[model samples]
Structure formats: structure tokens, C-alpha cells
Target: MPRSTFHRILSPLLLWRLRHINDRVYLILMSVLVGLAAGLAAVLLKTSVHGAQQLLYSWVPEEKRVFALFLYPIIGVALTVLFTRYFLGGTLSRGIGPVIYNIARQNSIVPRSKMYSQLVTSFLTVTFGGSAGLEAPISVTGSALGSNLARILRVSRRERRLLVGCGAAAGVAAIFNSPIAGVLFAVEVVLSELSAPFFIPLLISSATATVVSKGLYEGQPFVLITNSWPVQAIPFYVMLGLGTALLSVYMLRVYFRADDFFERWPGTFRKVVLGGLALGLLVFLFPPLYGEGYNIVQALLAGKPEQLTDSSIFSVYRDENVWILLLVATASMLLKVFATCITVGAGGNGGMFGSSLFTGALGGFVFARLINLSGLYPISEVHFIVLGMAGTLAGVVHAPLTAIFLIAEITGGYALFVPLMLVTSSSYLISRYFEPYSVYTRKLVQKGVIVHADRDRGLFAQLDPLSMVQTDFMPIHPESTLGDLVTVFRHSTRSIFPVVDAEQQLVGLVTVDTIRDALFDDEHYNTIRVADLMAPPPAIIEPGDSLLDTLGSMDQHGAWALPVVNKGKYVGFILKSAILAGYRRQLLKESE
Candidate 1:
């Protein structure tokens, strides 16, 4: 109770408390910064894409507005093919993984070179009437921003990885102008885990990114839907959900198959040229099928059925154009899928998120129109638009929560929450039940990446701690004399060793540092028992317990090594070197 004793006791506790606070504050502030960058990056990318579209359109003669339908795609494909092949060499992956690849492996590679290539390619794809979106690529840019910044700041490895997720979430939030949805996207899709450790940073980044994204585009989702359906039509959401699920699976399959087919082509330029030519030909038929398909969605929501109903073939026709557009949409969806698959498969630069949405919307439109005509409780086409978007996303990405929330936020209405939930969940369940893998995971699996949690562990939570533990271990007897132990320690390179009783019952551990002083004194060395030199109550882990627990215990005890024990017997000892090696291997495997 004396002042000296109180000071001695309180100082260590205070220091410990300060360190904890500092770590938490550091992670929070970093996450916020990540979010802000993501949001700004998303806006910049979106604006750049829009600007590119404007520039391309301006170059065209007004009389050739329809001609753009054919020419723009050809140009986009040519440019993308050139850039992706000669410059990028095809290391960049679509969607979140390329960036996630950096964080999980390659020491946060960020792919700065690939980012620029994608920007140009995505711009052309969106601007010139290729059916795709900028959402995924934008997030990759944000993630690259966060990873590169963290690398520059010399942030810790674990924190840096978390920041990567933050940046991705922020980018997504900024792109869609939805904060909550962004956070969930990062967690549900990017980080693949949800917990207190990740929640604060991810949330801060998402919120900041949302603010930045909103500041750019009037702060609404890119797609705005306005519909007022009779409450009685709610029941039909079931059929809508079912239709959406079916279409989503079909869409993913078709896209993958097309991609696989096209990838067999002889050369990069040929593939690009053929894909471009095919897209161009489709544009001549239905001008709306070109580029990001935003104009088509806009045209659809306005209910100008003339595009699908007109009879004139080349007059920028109406109703006939709609049918053509529908056929084109279906073809374009298949083409876009193949284009995206080919782009990624053949090493061309792009992201699939946009293409998925484009195809999803088209799928939704067709299904909704069919249901509308069937007199099935008078469902609105707009509802299918929303449901189809969520369903398509859910099936491919396997992130139902992100898909549902994204639809609600982007659509600017919570009214679809119930339906979004029903449809997205069903879509994911059906796709995953049949395939047991999302597009990304399937790719990883094909590359020989053995994932344990491909079924229940979620995408990001698939880290295996047991793989870090070395099965072979060195054992020492507790009854051995200090002199004998010194000789044994001298021949061994391990810094710490598990000491067991003569019967091999668990006892304790001793570090080489502990016996260093006694080595010079011959009498003391010969007299001291191994137990006398050992640190009592060694940190231990059960074989069945998670490596996460082992890591936590080691950190808590400040131990360089932990013993693995079951019942009363010592099983093996985890050398600290093994942990580091395991971390590197696990991360590297994910990156490749």
C-alpha cells in the first residue's frame, strides 16, 4: 500500500492500458482514412468513365449515333486487348481478389500498373456500350490505394490486411452511395469475417467512402427505381424470387461457358477482335446493347416500349428495337460474360461486378416482363429489376447480404428489403447448393488452392492455423541435470524446449537464455535439476483447438513457443519460426 509499491504495481498496468488504447486508435484512424480514399477514388473512377464516354460520343457524328452501337464496342475491345496483353501480361484478376491477393499474398502488391489498365478498359467498356459496370474495378483501385498507403506508412501486416478490406468496403460504399451496404460488402465479401476487431475500422472506412461517393453523383445509387405496386402483389415476390434464382444460375453458367469457349482462341488480338466484332454486330441490331448497359436500363425504366415494338429495321426503330434489344440483351449478356471471362482468362484487364449487374438487370427485365404479361398478381417490372439485380449478384459472388443491401441502397428504397432478402438468399442457396463454390473460389480451387471452409467457413475465414503447427518436436527430460541439459541445448538450435517428466508427463519449458548464466559455474550446473531451471506452467494448446487460440495464448503469455498437450501428456511444441513460416505460406497461397 506504500507509495513505492503502488507506483510499481500501477505503472505496468497503466502502460499496458495505454498500449491497448494506442493500438485501437491507430486501427480506427487508419480505417477512416482508408474509407475516405476509397470514396474519393470511386468518384474519380466513375467520373473518368463518364468523361471517356462523353469524349467517345462527341467524336461520333450525330448521324452516326446508331453507328456508335457497332463501332464503339470494336474500339473498346481493340484498346482493351492491346493494353491488357502488351502491358499488363494478365496478372490482374477481376473483382476483389487481385487486391485481396496482394493483401493475402505478394505483400500487398496493389497492382498499380493493372489499376490504370483497368481504368482505361472499364471506361471504354462502359463508355462505348460494352455491357459492364465500374463498381468492382473502382473498389480494386480503392483497395490498391489503401494497401499502397499502408505499405508506405509501414503499418503492421495484420493491420494492413484489415485496411485492404476497409479500402474495398469504402470503395464499394462510395460507388453505390450506401454506407451500411459497403461495410457489409467488405465483411461479407472482402474480409470474409465479421467481428469486433474488424467492425470499427470497416465501418469507419465504409462511412467515409459513402460520403465521398455521395458527393460526386447526387449521392444516390446509379440506378434509381420508382414504382408503386398494390400491396396484394407482394405474394408474387415468391415466384419472382424463384425466377431470379433460376436466371442467375443460368446467367453465371452461360457466362462461364462462353468465356471458356472464347479462351481457346489462338491469339489475344484475335479473341479481342472477334469478341469486339460480335458485340459490334449486335449493336447494329439494337444500339442499346453497347457499353455498361446503363442507357438500356434507363430506357427500360422509362417504359418506352417502342424500342421493343417498332417495325423499321434501320431507323433507330422502336418496338422492334426492344425485341432486338432483348435478343441483343440476352446475346450481350452471354457476350459480356464471355468478354469478361475472356478478358480475365486471356489476361485482358477488367472486373466482373459490372458485367454481372448488367446481365442481371437484363435478365430481370425479361423475367419481369414475362411475369407481368402472365397476370400473376400484377407485379411491377421495377420489382423484378431490383430482385434480378440482387439475385444475379448473389449467385455469382455468393454474398447474399451484400447483394441484398446493395440493391436496397442503390435502388433508394427499403421497400424491397423483404423481397431482396427472399430472392438473394434463394439465389445464393441454389447456386451454392448446386456448385458449392462461387466464381472466385472455383478459380482458386482449380489452381490447386485447398480451401477447408469452401462450404461453411465463409470465404475470408478460411485461414488454417493447424497447418502452422509442426508435427515433429524435440523433447527433453525434466530429471536431466543442468550440466546434461546444457550439452543437449548446445547441440540443439531451438531456443526453447518442452521438458517432460521421466514418464513423459507434461512439466514445463526452459529457454536457452534461462541457463546461460549457470553455464560458467560447473558446480551449480551439475547440481541444478532441469525442473529448477524451467519456467513453470508453460503455455499449452490442445490438438483439436484452433490455431487462433494458440496464437492468442502465445501473445498473452509473451512466449516464444507453446506446448501442445492432450490429457496429461506432452504431444508437440510449436516453434515460433513455424508460425511465421505458416503465415507466409497461407498468405502466399491465397495471393497466387
Candidate 2:
């Protein structure tokens, strides 16, 4: 149906609902609906990717599969680029970063195109052997759904943002079948602030989405056969945590550097050709780097590390020595980030969420195998494999709680909860010390985009400093006498006046107190120029300055207002009172 027609049909029902349903009850209903839609979107993307992979590779012979792997990613990335260029207007934002940005800067309003753009592009990228994860794309799709749904319902900005979080949580829950982890992800990563009221909606949305996914899809992503985690492995877990933290930092730095290099490499065609070929060569050398690599994680969890080399040239060396397998695993883990960067930087649509897990599993497997070979102790490779995933996820995303519960819930047990807590916390603290922001937030922070997890900073970011610029203060000429200043002051409501030159550049400020003594003496009214009565302002503000920085300047100078100057010209003054009032209005809006 057309949008106008749809709105017309639902207008009466919406009015009835507003009269009969309270806000809390309406929010619950909206959460369930959004969850269901988000779940279906996730299920559709996963199924399409699986189906495409099967259709493309199911007919190929095992002996010649290596050749197919070399050709598929190039074709996939090319197709993705073509689709994005022709169909999506040559722009597609893939990952959780854009979604977080929308919430922070765009009033939680996601573009309608995002609801389907990510699904189609990510399907082509991942299904055709692109080394990226569908989780981020699906989450973006879900967030778009929630945001647009709130738009249709004509809800307040606060409620719309909540719905956005609901959709994101639902997507995560449906993808992993871990509702608790989904809720935590929304709190830790998406929502700027969390309160008691947010819990019920988040829980309801996540659980509902999980139900929809389970009803349509079967089986978990990875199955863990381990029953218990030994206490003696605590030392190994600690070491593993430290190792994953360092690895997380390495992955973030390498991915960003490679992405930047590709960005500066000039032509799009060159990037596609060179990046696709490079990615294909990497995947061809290490078969485990193909696609999301969840299958490798499953194989590792199943205690069959040999399978990683099944379709590779390293297959011949798989059984020669345990050290050979370790070498291949180490190489694969180190190079996975490059493959992911090429896939994305070359126009593939996907995220690093799965790459981190893939590298972590390999890192954990290598760590455990080396320990056993040392003849010092025997550790469960399975336990460390799982712990490695949690540790790296915690460090990479900077959300330790989400990592802990996600691993625990997906593994179908909290058997490793003790070790998970120890490892994830350690990794998070260490990673945070080295890299303050997560992979999703690092570039956004560097570009001065508002991606804060703190409530005050987030709220203040929503208040634009330029909008509060007060142009009501009368501009006075520097050559004006005290008689002219008295005439302007009588007609002006403000206590301060800006003295400007011929070019409208602010020279100084003249306040009521600055000329209090001059007002009583009219003998020198024509003698004393306005330049003699004015003094330099305490501080100057720019149009692009942040509210927090403006507040800091105001506090430091003990000034109630600061002149807003841009490009050597005076615009107006920004009063501290306006900022406080705007902040209070924002706070009240969010509370509602």
C-alpha cells in the first residue's frame, strides 16, 4: 500500500489506541511487533546466504574446489559493487557504526533504504566467499526496521530511539539465539543510557525475536561438547586473556591501516580488481578464511583442528606434524583481518564481528596446543577455544558482559562462566588501556562524531551549539560616542553590546557595568569613543564547537556568555543559560 493510504487507513485505529492504551502498554506491543519483523529479516538473510553458498558450490567437485574458491570472491565483490552502484545509488553503509551514529546524531531516524540494502549486499558478499560476517548487516537491517516503524507510528523521538534499540537487540538475539546477550549488546553498544524502564522492552523484544528465529530456523551456530571447566586452567585463561587483548589491538590497527590504504589507492575499479584478487589469493591459501569462518569455529569446538586444512595446499602437511598444523593455524589467524578488510574496503558488505571470533578460536587453539606440546600441563582445547572467543570479542568490541553472556548462552551452558568472567574482564581492561574505543567506534571518534557511552556527553552532543547563538545583542561601531551608546542601550534588551569594525569583525565588548560610571557623566559623552569604553571578551566560541567545550570555556572564564565567531567574523553570543535550558529540555524529552 502507498504510505499515504496506509496512514489514512490506520489513522482512526491509532487515535483509538492513543485514547485506550497507556504508554507502557503501547511500548510493549510495539516491542513485540518490531522483534518479530527483525527476527524474520535475520532469518531471511541467513537462509539466503546459506542457500546461495550451496547452489554455487554444491555441484563442484572436491578436487577442483580450490579453483572455485579463487574465482568466487572476485565475482562476488564485483557483483556487490555493481549492485551498490546501480541499485543503491553508489552508497551503502554496512556495520554497527552507522546505526550508532544515527542514534547519536540523527535523532534515531535510520534511512528506509538500509532495511533492505544491507540484506541484499551482505548476501552477495558472504555467500560468494567474501571474508566477512552477516551479523552486523542484519543488525543494521533490524535497526532500520525499528526506526522506520516508529516513524510510521508517529511516536516521540525518545520512543523511536527505544524502538531502534529493540530492533538491534532482536537482530542479535535472533542471530545467536541468545536473548540475554542481545539485551546486553543494546545496553553496552547501542543505547547511550540505560534505566530500569528499558529492561522490560528490551527483554520482551529479544525473547520474541529468539522465538521467531527458533520457530523458523534449527540448530545453534556452534555446538560445545565440553561439560565442565577445570579450575587448574585459570592460569592458562589469564594468559589467554592477555594474549587475546594484544591480538585484538593488533587486529584493530591492521584492519584500519589496510582500509585506509585501500581508501587512498585511487580508482574504484583498481580497488575492486586488486583487492578481490588479493582476498582470493589469501582465501585460496587458507581455506578457513573463506566467508564468516563459523564452520572453522565449529570444527575447532568439536576438537577436529585438522579440518581447517581440508581444502588448502596445507592438507599434505596436516598429518605430518602437530607443529605444521599449528603453523597454518597461526598464519590463518594473523591474515584473517586482511582478508576481511579487503572484502569490505573493496565494496563488500559485512563486519568484523565474525572475524574476531574466527581469529580468537584459532588463537585459542594454537595457545592450547603449544602448552600441551611443552609437556608442562594438559588443558582442554575446547575450553580455551570458547574462552578465546569471549576474550577477543570483549576486547575488540569493548563489551565484556555481552561477550561473556553471548558465549555462555550460545554454548548452551554457563559451565565456563567462572573462566569467562576472568578472561573477558582481563581482556577488556587491557584492551581499553591500549585502545579507548572499540573497532566500531574508533574511526567515528577520530572524526569527531558523537559515539559516547556516557549519558551526559551523549545528551549534550544532541544539543547543537550553533542553534543557541544569540544574535539579539546590538552591534555597536567602535567610533560611536557615549551619547550614541546610550541611545542604543535604551532600545536594546541585552546588557552587553559587541563593538565591531567596518568588516563586522568583533573587536571588544561593552557591558552595562563597563560604562556604569560613564552613564552618570554626560560631559564626556561625545569625547569618550565606544572603543575606549569596550574591553576584550573573556572568550570566543566557534560555530563548530561542542557544547561541553563551550561550557568549559564559560566556567573557566567565569563568563555567562561568549561571543561566537566564525572565520574572523562575529556571529553572535552563546549564553550559558540557553545551554542549561536546552539540556534540561533534552533530559525531559528522553525521560518521557
Candidate 3:
């Protein structure tokens, strides 16, 4: 049935049910439904990608797989571009970044098309080896599912936002089969605020999603069968923490630089040809850099680092010297970020979540191997490999708790909790000291969309400055005499009047104080033009300015009101009282 027809049939039933049910109880039921849907979406994406990969490569022999690696990424990216352009309406927003942006700036309302756009595009990108991850795309899809469902049910905006969080939590939970991690991810990464009331629904959603995922998908992403970590390895874990922290910073800088480079290219075809060839070359050189690189992580965890070089040109060199294996692992870890950037920047849909994990696994392997080779320590490579995943995840995303729990849950135990806390905390602190924003939020912070660290600035980001502009203030032409200004001021309740030219461009402001003395002098009122009495405003606000910027200008100029101009034309004045009122109203809305 058409969506409109379906909604028309379901709307009355839902409305009647809501009238008879407690809202909190109703929300729990909705959370369960959202979780099931999000989990199914996650499973669908994984199955489709895995199926496509097997179909593509199961037929190709091992010896000639290198040739497939060189050609598949190019084709995958090209197909993704075509699909996005023609099928997805010429644009597709990929990754958790856009989801967070929607929550912060778009009133938590995700586009309806996002329910399937990222899934299809990411499948095309990653299935044939675009060197990216599926988690972000699926999370975006899940968020969309929640948002659109709430819209269809005619829920309040606050309830819609909560469901969006539920959907995101479900997606992460389903993808990794880690419910606690999913809830934490929703709290720490997706949702702006956390309260006791949020936990029950989040838990319900995450647990439900995990159940759905486990029922259908049968394996964990990584398996660990290690004993408790040795006390003597504390120092080595500390060193690995520092190594992962540095690697996190390096990846962030390089990924953005690569994105910038790709953005400079003129057109989609140019970006695809250039980025595809470069990515294919990198994958050909290091087969471990192919796809999400989870297989490489598996090899590392299983103590088979040699398997990393199995399909590469360096396969022969793998048996010759241990240093060659170490070199390949190190190089692949460093280059994984570039491959990810190229894939996404060249029109493929993916995110840095998996790449960060891939880099961390390799870094841990290389770190442990070096120490063992030096005859310094015989630490458990598996422990470091797992811990490295947590370390980089914490550092790159700045979510230490999520990193700690995700690793613990995915590994089937919390055996490494002590070291998990140590490594994740250290890596997160070090990475934050160098770069204030995470990989997902750096550009957002630069563009002033949201300030992740400050609740006040974040709230300000959500309140649009344009919404508070006081257009009721009368505007007077610059050529108008003081008598004309007096006429506008007498009829208007505002204490300030904008002086505009014939073209409607704002020239200056005429405040009551500026013309106070001349008001009583009838002779001077006729002789003194409005332009002569008017003074330039201390500051001007743009239509796109955030409330934070607007308030900052108000504070800086000590002005009770400021004029808003767009392309030199006067839009209106924004008063301090009006902003405060809007803030109070926003707070009330959020509380409700």
C-alpha cells in the first residue's frame, strides 16, 4: 500500500490507543517496535553485504584475487555514485555524523529516504571492496526508521527524539550484538541529554534489537579465548595506550586531509576515477586493507599474523622474515585511514568507526610483535589486539565507556576490564589533549553546528536565530527627516528604528537616545535628517548566525538589541529579551 494510505488506516487506531494508554507505557511499546525494526535493518544490511562479497569472490581463485582487488573498488564506487545519483535523488548523507547533526540542528527529524539510502549505497561501496565499514550506514538507517515511524504515528517532537535514540541504540546493538554498548553509544554519542527516564526505554530497545540480531545472525565479530591479563603486562598496556593515542590523532589528521584533497576535484566522475584508482592501488599493495579489514582483525586475534599477507604480492616475503610481516602490518595500519577517506570521499558511503578498529587491531599486533622481538616482554598479543580496538575507538570517538563495554561484550567477557579502562581512558585523554573534537564532530564544530562539550552552546545551536528576529520594529528611510523618524517611533512600541536606503539596505540605526534632545526642538526636527541623527550599529547579525553567535554579539557590544541583515538588506532586529524568552520556551519544550 502507499504510505499515505497506510497512514490513513493506522492513524485513527493509534490515536485511539494513545488516548487509553499512559504515555510512558506507550513509549516502551514503541521502543520495542523500533528496536525490532532497527535490528532487522542491521541484519539485512550485513546479510546483503556478506552475500554480495561471497558472490563476487567465491568464484575467483586465490591466485587471481589480487587482480579483483585492483578492479572491484573502482567498479564499486562507480556503481555507488550511479545509485546515489539516480535512485537516491542525487544525494545521500552517510555515517553517524549526519545523524548527530540531525539531532542537534534538524530537531532530531531524519529524512525519510535515509531508511534505505545508506544501506543500499554502503552495500555497493563495501561489498565489492570500497574499504569502509557498515556500522555507520546501518545506524543512520535505524535512526531514520525511528524518526519516520514517530512522524507517521503523530508523536510529539520529544517522543520522536526519544524514538530516534532508540532506533540508533538498536542499530548498534544489532550490528555487534552488544546491548550495553548500544545503550551507551546512544547516550554518549547520539542523544544530547541523559536522564533516569531514558534508561528504561534505551535498555528495552537495545535488548530487543540484540535478541533479534542473535536470533538471525549467528556469530560474534571477534572471538577471544584468553586467560586473565597478567599483572606484569600493565606497563606494556600503558605503552600500547600511548601508541594507540598517537595513531588516533594521526588518523584524524590524515583522514580530513584526504577528504579535503578529494573535495578539490571538480566532478563526481573525476573524484571516482582518481579516488578509485588510488584506493585500488593501495588495496592491491596490501590485501589486508581490503573491505572493513575485520578478517585481518580475526587473523590477529587468532595469532595468525602471517595470514594478513596471504593474498598480497608480499605473500612470499611473509615466510622469509618476521620483519616483513611486521612492516606490512604497520604500513597497512597507517594506510587504512587513507583508504577509508578515499572510499567515502569518492562517493562511496561508509564511516571511520570500522577503520578505527581496523587500525587499532593492526597497531596492537605490531606493538606486541615489536616488544616480543626485542626480548623485552612476552605479552599476550590477543589481549593487546583487543585492547587496541578499545583504545582507538575511545580516542577517535571520545567515548571511553562505549569503547570499554563494546570490546568487553563483543569479546564475550570482561576479562580485560581493568586494562580496558586503563587503555581507553589514557588514549581518550591523550587524543583530546591534542584535538578537542572527535573525528565525527570536527567539521561540525568548525561550522558552528554544535558544541559537543558545552550544553549551553549545544542548546544554543538548536535554537535558530532567525526565529527570534523582531520584525515588528518600524523601518525608516535614511533620507527621512527627524520628523518622519519621530512619526515611526510614536506609532511603534520599539525604542529603536532601522534607517534604510531606497534599496532597502540597512544604513544605520536611530535609537531613542540618539534623537532624544532633538525631539523637543521643532525647528531642528525639520532641519536634521534621519541620516544625521542615526549612528552605525555596534554589530550586525546574519540570518545564519546561531543563537550563541547572536548572544555573543549582544554581549560584546553591550547592546540590548541588534539588527539582522541578509545580503545588506535589513531583515529585522533581535532583542535580548526575545532571545531569553526563546531560550526559556526551548527549555520548557525539552522538559516536556
TM-score, structure 3 vs. true: 0.95
Candidate 3 residue lDDT tens string, 57-113 = 988999899999999999999999999989988888767888888888888899999
Evaluated at residue 340, the lDDT of candidate 3 is: 94
For model 2 the local lDDT of residue 307 reads 90
On TM-score, the candidate that comes out on top is 3
Local distance difference test scores for all models = 0.67, 0.90, 0.88
- Clashes (candidate 3): 0
lDDT for model 2 comes to 0.90
What TM-score would every model get versus the actual structure? 0.70, 0.93, 0.95
- Clash pairs, model 2 backbone: none
How high is the lDDT of residue 564 in model 2?
Answer: 94
1 versus 2: better lDDT goes to: 2
Tens-digit per-residue lDDT, 366-483, candidate 1: 7777666677655667767767778888888778888888878877757667777877887788877766666655655453333324422222234444555654556678878888
Model 1 regions lying over 4 Å from their true place: 1-21, 85-91, 107-109, 112-115, 219-231, 262-264, 305-317, 320-336, 342-348, 450-592
Deviation from native of the Cα of residue 449 in model 1, angstroms: 3.2
Ranking by TM-score: 3, 2, 1
